[model samples]
Target: MKRLLKLYLNTFDGLSREVWWLALITLINRAGTMVIPFLSLYLTEDLEFSPSTVGSIMAAFGLGSVVGSWLGGKLTDKIGYYKIMVFSLFVSGLLFVLLQYLKTVLSLSIGIFVLMLVADMFRPAMFVALSAYSKPENKTRSVTLIRLAINLGFSAGPAIGGLIIAGLGYNGLFWVDGITCILATLLLIQLLNPKKSKVLDEVKVEEPYSAYKDKAFIIFLFALFLFGVMFLQYFSTMPIYYRDSHFLTEPEIGLLLGANGFFIFLLEMPLIKWLENTRFNKVILIWFGALLTSLSLLILNFTTWSGILIIGMFLMTVGEMIAFPFANAFALQQAKKGNQGEYMALYSIAFSFAHIFGHKAGLESVSVYGFDNTWYIFTAVGVLCMFLLLILKQFLKAKNIIS
Candidate 1:
């Protein structure tokens, strides 16, 4: 037991105190993440919106995310990450409270868009902060620590959210989510002093559009966009599929989703530590991870059994664990000093783009072609993204862009 404990501690050895505080803030924020996972279900079942309408509303949230990420990146470079993060958290919390009162489709759609706009602006800022806090050699593990906190909080949130939905209902979810965001903001103010945080001292006055010029990075971002599209199905269409196709209740769906978080919490840090010590190529590892994501979705075509759903989610979580943190680390490596915010912001946009298209694709396909075909489509896209990543690796190697 002592040996195992020592090994676990060794995996997290070099990360700074600020990184741990960032992880704590992430855990607190995500622990109340009751909204996005259930937003589609709420629009469909509770409000009686059509699937298409739900998709549009969800896409609206993505639209806001797109704007938020771009704006956040620019702002982080100009004003620094501290102010941007604190502002995003407090305002987004108030927006969540406002979301509870919205009823009609137009109102809810507009509200959701605005809420996500404010909420998602924090993403790039947070990434910039993470990079600032971490030493170069420990960057990947630093990011993974934050992810571990996120997954741990996710494990708690959905299970508790299930109970909240069961008792106090969806309104209860909004309240809890809103309150937590406010609390996270307060913690940030108290714990993260600008003078104490280890931000990069060098500043370069590059144009906002500078990151767009790197062709290899552009290809990488596109591949990430595709991966994001497929991966996001877990939050978007997957819940609806479970509810409508399998006839599972909210609590059951929560448990299934929660299981993904539980697995990541247990495995991600150790897995990254192992990978760091190995001779395996980062590109190849990411490709395998992408392939696994497709396999996770393809498994759904074979069976809709409850046991199978859990298994599929587990595979998806594994893929996420392998791919995402490495992807972030790779992006950080590719970035020039003083441009981390711009690079990270561009990467964040890939997910926002996924939000824009993934929900539309999943919801529309289900509305038109049916669920099985939607899964098939997702599987095909994931495979295609793997090829893109492979090509990106070769390009980077040929150009000596990565060591």
Candidate 2:
């Protein structure tokens, strides 16, 4: 136990103060993330929107994300991450509050699109800020630290959100979500002033790279996109599964989802730290993690027992712990100093694309083919993603990008 504690503590030793502040801001913003988890339910039950309309609104969210990511990247390069982060956070807060008043399908759809467009602008900028704040060697650990904050907030967010919905209804969630975004922005302004900070100073790159022109990186992003499609179903379809198949309550469903975040918060930092010291190829580690994630879904076909749910969630958490931080670090490595924002923006866009297609596809599949077959489809996606990664691995080797 003493040795375990020491190892966990050591994972945090080398990250900069800016990274911690960034992580804290992320925690604050995400802690009030009450709406997305319950968005489909709210639209369907309260607003009496049809399933098709809900699907379209969700798709709009993804479309906005793609646009936001591109615009954010361009702005971050032209202006700086500081301004983008501040503007995105502040405006997005206001939009979240405004979203509650839109009753019509058209108004709500457009509102969600605008909300996400502004909200997702923060992502690529945050990645750029992370790169600025972290030391070269500590980059992956720094990513893990930020992820710890995100997962930790997610662990508490859904469960608390469930209780909030019970007491105050869906409207309460919108207010809390909006307020947290504003509060987080204020914290960022107070704690991490770009003018006062030394790291934001521009560094010259001997060879500048364009993210769009990199063939290998495109392949990598495609693979990440596939992985994201499978990963994101936990938000869209799995909750419905828990309710329909096992007859779980809203709070119970929240607890089950929260468990994934809780496990990652406790274990991912140490796990990534240990993996970083190993000789294994990062892509190979990612492939292995993808396989585990696939099996997590595949396990559902074998039994009807509720105990299987715990096992599935555990495997998925471990797989996420292994895959995500290294994937982030690899994306950062691909960027030259001059194009960090562009590269990370494309990286963010990959997952955004997944959100665009994945949730809609998962829901349609579940509706048409039933839950068991939908799990199979996602499992198949994970396997195909692994194959793509393997191709990328060999491609990297041929180019001497990795040894």
Best by the TM-score measure: 2
Residue pair clashes in candidate 1? none
Compared with the true structure, what per-residue lDDT tens digits does model 2 show for residues 1-403?
9998897898899788899999999998888766887898999999998988898887888899999998898898878899999999999999988899999988988999898889888999999889888887888889999998888787677778889899999999899889999999899999888876658324457776788888878988999999999998988899999999999998898789878877887888888888888998789898988999999999999999998999999999999999998899888878753487888899999999998888889999999999999999999999999999999999999988872
Model 1 lDDT per residue over 219-278, tens place? 889989999999989887999999998899988997887788777777888999999888
Candidate 1 — which residues are off by over 4 angstroms?
40-54, 162-172, 200-209, 237-255, 299-311, 366-373
TM-score of each: 0.87, 0.92
Q: Model 2, residue 271: displacement in angstroms?
A: 0.5
Question: Residue-pair clashes per candidate, as listed?
Answer: 0, 0
Clashing pairs in 2: none
